[model samples]
Target: MAAVVHRLAGPALLAHRDGIRAVYAAAFAEPPWHAEPAEADGYLTRLAGDVQRPGFAGAVALDGERVLGFATAWTSSTPLPGTRSYPRVTAALGAERAAAWLCGGTEVDELAVSPAAHGRGLGRTLLEAVTRDAPDARCWLLTSVRADATVRFYERLGWRQVTHPAPDGYGTAVFLGPGHPARAAAVLPSL
Candidate 1:
């Protein structure tokens, strides 16, 4: 499919809003995610606001005018957000580690590729495009451990899993970028 991935500051992604939403709806409908189709609409709504956040960045993969995949990210807040998976992430990594590893660093919030577009490397391409400008490559993202393939994909890309969900805890794990400063010294559990 000769898809081209374009990294952008936000507006460009918004321009492909409907296409991006379709990709999200399709990609997350499978496996452990099983996100509702309506969730894609909500995501786009929240994304409109997310672009206003500090260090906001985005990327979209397009095969002609059709969106094959997309990725979004921004600087992690200093005080640490208390929403979505933030609380769980803090619980997993602890306040000190979370603040140091995530705060002010690029936080990869979403990476999605349509089911029909799988195996084309669009996910990795979008991920790299979005995080390309991460300061010192200090990037991080959280995903469900239940999604084995997703976890493996990040690991295969050299991202270091820096947190292991506590045995009676949530199923999320945080991963640091391959070249992130803390990744090298991270003594966290192995995948």
Candidate 2:
């Protein structure tokens, strides 16, 4: 069956909470993520709080009540954040570019598609559903360079890599959405 993608407001994601957790547990259990089961628990906790953040928005793909994928995003702020991968992202882009290009833009925090749904384009559909309302198409996301296929997937979707992923391919790469104002200038793939 074809899946339907829905743009959800904050807190509303909780309606599909269990389904979301199931997809997260399955999608991120391999490759660079290798998320521990406990991480899924932590994600649930974080989602509860994330729903309250300003400009918070999300999307969920349902194949008849079963969540096939999901995406979450919210507006970023100046000075950057000190949590999770934000510091590394900020350093890679530098303070000037970070604030000008990313701050106030939609920051995609999470996007997951179940392995079972991999070839059906649900990933791209979920991403666009979540980012469609980004102010000026100024949306961005970061993923580990270790996830080579992931990097390529975003590139194929017209996202531009803004920061060099790293020499050993160990660092995260920040990507500017296709319509971002600064997309043209971020052409170089080297640091």
lDDT by residue (1-191, candidate 2, tens digit) is: 78999999876788999999999999889988999888888898999999898888999999999999999999897767888777777777777888999999999999999898888888898899888889999999988777888888998999988776542355777889989999877758543
State the lDDT of candidate 1 residue by residue for 1-191, as single tens digits. Answer: 59999998788789999999999999899878888999999999999999999999999999999999999999999978788788877877778888888998999999988888889998899999878889888999988888888888999999987776532367777899998999866787655
Candidate 2: what lDDT?
Answer: 0.87
> What is the lDDT of every predicted structure here?
0.88, 0.87
What TM-score should be assigned to candidate 1? Answer: 0.94
* C-alpha lDDT of residue 73 in model 2: 93
How high is the lDDT of residue 42 in model 1? 96
Q: List TM-score per model, in order.
A: 0.94, 0.94
Show pairs that collide, candidate 2: none
Residues forming the 10-long window of minimal summed lDDT in candidate 1: 163-172
TM-score, prediction 2: 0.94
